[model samples]
Target: MKLPLFPLNAHVFPGGKLSLRIFEARYLRMIKERAGKEPCFAMGMLEDREGGAEVLPWATQVRMVDFSQLEDGLLGIVVEGVQWLHIEDITTDDDGLRWADCKPVSIWSEPNHEQDASINSALLSLFGQYPELGKLYPEAAGQSMDWSLQRWLEVLPIDAGNKVSLLNQLNSKPAFEFVNNLLHQGDP
Candidate 1:
């Protein structure tokens, strides 16, 4: 399917939230056209380049949930990731809006283990300390291993290259182990 693409220098995973400040004319038009139809778009991470911006292959299908004007007088939008997408082809319009032919990719399924209470509590406490992040998500954000795993992947201050490598995995076991190790590292 052809979807409008917004490449950012950030990582967004399934069930994660992202806030963007829209100012460019092409994106402004894209948002206006997408307002009532689906409110969905594809998000790709900007790849490292010598001078120009490049987007990675893996991306997330995000749905806009809220919009407002920021203090600096720019249009701000909050979006939540719905699923993963793989770009088949991409083309940019004259106005610089990118449209991509994409296919949805299935992310890792819930692991066989039960939710880790300690990790969940830590995530909850972190969210409690920052209500702004809490407000972007649904009430059930960090309640499950799947949700917690995705959230951890989203918020961790890790390298984008590592994130892209992790996302390319066919199974989520590696990601699960990674998050599990990180959580254990904080143990007293």
Candidate 2:
């Protein structure tokens, strides 16, 4: 789908939560216009930096969940991860941020019963091994199995490139495998 773009060096995984500080004038305007009305938008990362502020050429989609204006006229917002997307084309304004044409590598679909069961069971197993996560994610034990799995994927602290790669994953098996590798430092 076509999306208004925000290019950054970081990646946001689907079902993840992102907190951002917006100080640039253009982005400030973008947020002011968007705020509560249109919380959903696309975000991408600059693989490389050119002389100007434009991104390298790709981006992902992101949705804004909560935002507030800081003392400096900047915006502090909470965003939820949506999907990984590739930029098909981009157009920039006077400021660095750009608008891009893009689409996700994998569209989200409601998990089936079997997938749900597997995810739930996996979470139970993971919690047993990594109980520390329970402090930050108290809901882990009570959330729907699918949502718990998705949240675990979202909180990953990797860069934008990795998030995009994970988004390209086609099935629950691959997605779970990728996340497992990440947890184990097995991904290269």
RMSD of each: 2.3, 5.5
Question: What tens digits encode model 1's per-residue C-alpha lDDT throughout 40-76?
Answer: 7888877677797678777898888889999999999
Give the per-residue lDDT digits (tens) of candidate 2, residues 1-188.
Answer: 66667776655555655668888787887776666654367766655435645464455456787677778876788776666566788778777666777766653453434344555556667667766444334455556544554555545555445544544545355556665555557535
In candidate 1, residue 100 scores what lDDT? 86
**Model 1 clash tally, residue pairs:** 0
The worst-scoring run of ten residues by lDDT in candidate 1 lies at 108-117
In model 1, the clashing pairs are none
The Cα error of candidate 2 at residue 113, in Å, is 7.2
Question: Which candidate has the top score in lDDT?
Answer: 1
lDDT of 1: 0.79
> Residue 19 error for model 1, in Å?
1.6
In angstroms, the error of model 1 at 148 is 1.0
Structure candidate 2, residue pairs in collision? 43-60, 44-59, 44-60
